[model samples]
Target: MNIPNTYGHLPLAAEAAGAGHPVLTWAAVGVIVTAVGVCLVVLHRRRDTRSKRLTPGYDAATGALVVLDRLSAMTAIAGVTTELGELAGFISLLRVAEARSPEIPFGVIVATLDDYAASVFTANYATRLAADPSLLDSYLALARVQGVKLESARTAITTVQRRIEKLTGK
Candidate 1:
């Protein structure tokens, strides 16, 4: 009986076919699977560590204070818009912190931030009303309301910061 060498030109292919390199192929697959599994585990650990660090703590409190300070300094439409963008980012951080640790009293502060945003909206509306001189009193009233809301939010953030400082002993 004569066997034809179908892979006459490819020496490696002929040798692999005769040798039936099933073990080598399985070993390569096993190595690839192990590499992928290791990568997934490492990625999972990194994500867990990052999330743990982001949990509401001293850093978050300090960040809130900074955001609040910047927010308070903004008066013009452009400045206010920028500050509000920062505020929204800060709120997202707080929300993440809240999710990580439900024990923390972030709900109330989050609510305060919402109220602050609403007051800013009110102020924006009042500013638009400035075009109508007849609405001067209404605009002034809204401005005053916004000022009060700012103070309230500032107070809330400061209180949280103080508590965190005391807790951390820093």
Candidate 2:
């Protein structure tokens, strides 16, 4: 006599009766497919939103251009001052940068330059600012010369960034 075997333990009819295995398996597969579909939809939407935000033709582009323009303007101001006078002028420009472009990470550079300028000024004119008001004017004139060079340094940073973007097609 032949007997049906369900994995050598029971008949197929007995196993099928014990649980609706086929229906449960199909339900699980359906759920998995639905979950995968949902995930794909969400991922696609996120990618689309990100693309819109990062596109070079959008608001990011405008912000970058504005920053570049401001840097260029500062550079032009720096060109007319003498080396010593540049220092004071650069200090002023760095103040502007700090106010307008706080995200540029230029605070350290500006602070270093300011500290050096102050040290030089104090060393040279510590006794003058207290005597003659005209002495303060003279000190400012000298500081302005150094300020211009600091402005040039800032401009160099902007130029370097532009070059990198060009090379990378960014």
Candidate 3:
């Protein structure tokens, strides 16, 4: 059955609009996300590689070596006749370096340094008796003992430095 239309035909306009194709937009977003992720990964790996090259306790090791070298020089200049105050100063420096040394890498050297300090401690105290001609010979013998200890510590430090260099590829 045909019925008369109650409403007149009205023209409605529709406009088409879009930023771009959906696939291209999504693809661009994915590419940007992937690039950002890759950059972050590269940055992280670089930091790790740099840290590996640096090596842990490297500064401490070098610092201890410097202190020991200084002490060795002072001992060489002063010999067995080192003044009490100067000997005390060297002992203090040694103890400080030994305290800061890493337990794993420098333990043996630290022990050797401790022994060196012990001998120096005795020598420092025994210097008072050096005025006695009879005790002078004994003091010289003690000094010889300290020289041996010092050499051992130096050897140990050199070994550790070589190991650290090998590890860090430096």
Candidate 4:
């Protein structure tokens, strides 16, 4: 049996041997439209993902300050203010440094406090103090006696407070 080649092997052909490429049909148009719609949807989802994944800097700073505030309030020793004053001075230095270099980690302050509290009593106690503000007058005195330069720590609180308030207003 012999099979007849009804149509030429070339898919695109001119009926009169002079017609150009075939005109795209509605099915092709539908496919193109569907592809464009899918691309749009992917772009939208990527934007949403970026927004949702962004970390909250303002909230984190507020939380850290609250812990420090609580620890300050709970501590009760003669010149407790002075001992913590040195630590506060360190914070002030950090704040100023941060102003100069925003890449500074907030954890630096937290870690310093944790170490100072450990020298006085225990890390657990310091953490509790962080949660509630306990004792450390001697540490403050030693810091002052050794010239830790706590002037900035003493006044940096107000600066930090103002900065936070301004951020809040925005």
Q: Which candidate order results from sorting by TM-score in descending order?
A: 1, 3, 2, 4
- TM-score (C-alpha, index-matched) for candidate 3: 0.49
* Weakest ten-residue segment in model 1 by summed lDDT: 71-80
**1-170, model 4: which lDDT tens digit per residue?**
89988885755456556655445556688899999999989987865543332223334344445445555544423344345555455455455544543543444544444444433333254555566654466545644532322222223334444554443333
Report the C-alpha displacement of residue 40, candidate 4, in angstroms: 21
Best by TM-score: 1
Which parts of model 4 are misplaced by more than 4 Å? 1-55, 76-112, 115-169
Identify the leading candidate in terms of lDDT.
Answer: 1
Q: Candidates 1 and 2: which is better by lDDT?
A: 1
Candidate 2 residue 118 Cα shift, in angstroms, is 20
lDDT values of the candidates? Answer: 0.68, 0.50, 0.60, 0.47
Ranking by lDDT: 1, 3, 2, 4
Q: How far is candidate 1 from the true structure (C-alpha RMSD, Å)?
A: 14.4
Clash totals, every prediction: 0, 17, 0, 7
- lDDT by residue (5-119, candidate 1, tens digit) is 9968766774867866679888999999999999999987865665555435546656766877776766424334677777777788777776776655666567788777776
TM-scores, one per candidate: 0.57, 0.31, 0.49, 0.27
Error of 1 at 68 (Å): 2.2
Give one digit per residue, the lDDT tens place, for model 3 in 1-170.
Answer: 99988797754432144454678878999999999999999987875675454444455455555656666654433345344335345445444544554433556665776677676634354556755668777767877877788788778767876776665457
